[model samples]
Target: MSILDLFKKKPKVNGIIKYLNLEGWWLNELSDEEREIILNIYSPMGSENSIIEGEICSSSQTQLHFFWGLIGWFNKPELRHIAYKLISKAETFIDKSSEPLDVHFFYSTKLEVFYKDRDLRPNGLELAIQSCEQQIANAPAAATAFKQKYDGNLPAHKGYAQLAIILEKQKRYDEAISLCEKAKSQGWAGDWDKRIERCDKRAKA
Candidate 1:
């Protein structure tokens, strides 16, 4: 029986109660079941624009779920591009916001989504490093937000480490060293020291 049919009948009916219990369990257990049902009913894939809009709607809902659950649903390889697009849009909303906390959450969520899928993107590390630099420049307050979200010193240190690596790969030893030193000064742990040592060796070679 259809989910709606179960809900439509009187709650006192035994059959309706059984169906209601099953429907509730199905909805609660499966994340994509509602989407699947809706897609099956509407079949919007036949239209190109409808398909795009449907994907965006689905992604927005999934992102909200992940944000609330801390589930990292966007980490799935098939959904990476969709997640990226949604995050990019969210960044735009963040840029327009005057509230610091709201802006911080937007950027933090965007960064997490980007970081989780970093290995999948062709230039993910470089993009992440550049994104951090841009965020630092545009929203200095976000540093504190990052720290709160990632624990003390982690945000700055992680971003700087990635920047150092990218600069080193580009044969810019001095710049890499500078970022590594900054990360160290910001209380980055032993790994920052290792990065500095590697950069120093590369510079001398």
Candidate 2:
């Protein structure tokens, strides 16, 4: 079965039961049936850590250990789903705290998760655009933060024009064009005029 097809099926209770049966040392002391029930409750393909943590706090270490073991079993899409949930939870926690660095860390982790996982590349690009837009919206003053972080040159200027292409795909033409202009102004040495002209045509069309 394709990975997508495997994911479409509900995670099998038998699989979890078998795993737990063989690795009972990793679980809190529970009957085989009880472990089966717990697995049934938390065995969904993309189950969130928070949900698992809440249910298994009696032996949270076991859950963590199990995840470590299961890590090899997860395909990229499954990993992406897990990483995204983790990033979302981390963002929420960061928002509730007074730590700006925590927010940055979570966002950075989110980007890394997207970049490292091939199955997530498309979603990662989409998330990158959204993240940049959010950064611009929430702190318009820091619109150049990405540029500053990326060597004082926007992605469009650094031969990473693919970033602009992604923005255009998201229908964020103005932002894409603005990025193209920024790239041109920064002297990163791309055909900025052609890019701007293409964006203009896209905007009009």
Candidate 3:
């Protein structure tokens, strides 16, 4: 047998679930040798091809698992670009598929990352807004995901507030107020009332 045949095959679903149950211990507690072994085994599943642009595949369920597994590396400054690229591909896959609204949370999260990094790519916010709108369109699913999955980060509501603020800045009071109301109804716990009142007064003036 070849040298590659000596290592065990990739873990299955139960193995992944067990690893996740360790709550970040897998990476946080890994020794250099163990880490190297994992990298050698799984890197090809999620890694990009240096020679080709956008060559990473996220079209299948297995690939999505790989993509998500790489998300933990997003905390590392050096590996953030890889995380960004993987999620970008995942977003495209989501756009073309019938994925649930909650799956699009990364649209805002990734945009926030790019914004903080001052590396907003062309159409990034546009994509985020589109995904936010989709979430609003599927209110129940988004709300449940916000409460349970996101620990109440409320990405959809936050995205609406963001768009509302932009509209308010543009003096589009009606649209801004509409979005503010949507955000409020979608469990936004911010000072949207004041903004809505301001929009109302401005719209009447």
Name the candidate that leads on TM-score. 3
Candidate 1: tens digits of C-alpha lDDT, residues 38-118 = 323333233443211322322222222222222234545655554565455344434443344445344445556666656
Best by lDDT: 3
Of candidate 1, the 10-residue stretch with the lowest lDDT total is: 50-59
Q: Candidate 2's residue-wise lDDT over 1-205, tens digit each?
A: 7878756743223233233342333233335554454344444466554222333323322322343333322225544554454344334333333233223333434444554553446675566655444332322222244445556543322122545666777788887899878656544456768878888898899
Off by over 4 Å in 1: 1-71, 96-126, 135-156, 188-190
Error of 3 at 46 (Å): 21
lDDT per model vs. reference: 0.49, 0.46, 0.55
Poorest lDDT segment (10 consecutive residues) of candidate 2: 134-143
Better structure of 1 and 3 per lDDT: 3
TM-score of 1: 0.48
List TM-score per model, in order. 0.48, 0.35, 0.50
What lDDT is obtained when candidate 2 is compared to the true structure? 0.46
Candidate 2 structure, TM-score to reference: 0.35
Ranking by lDDT: 3, 1, 2
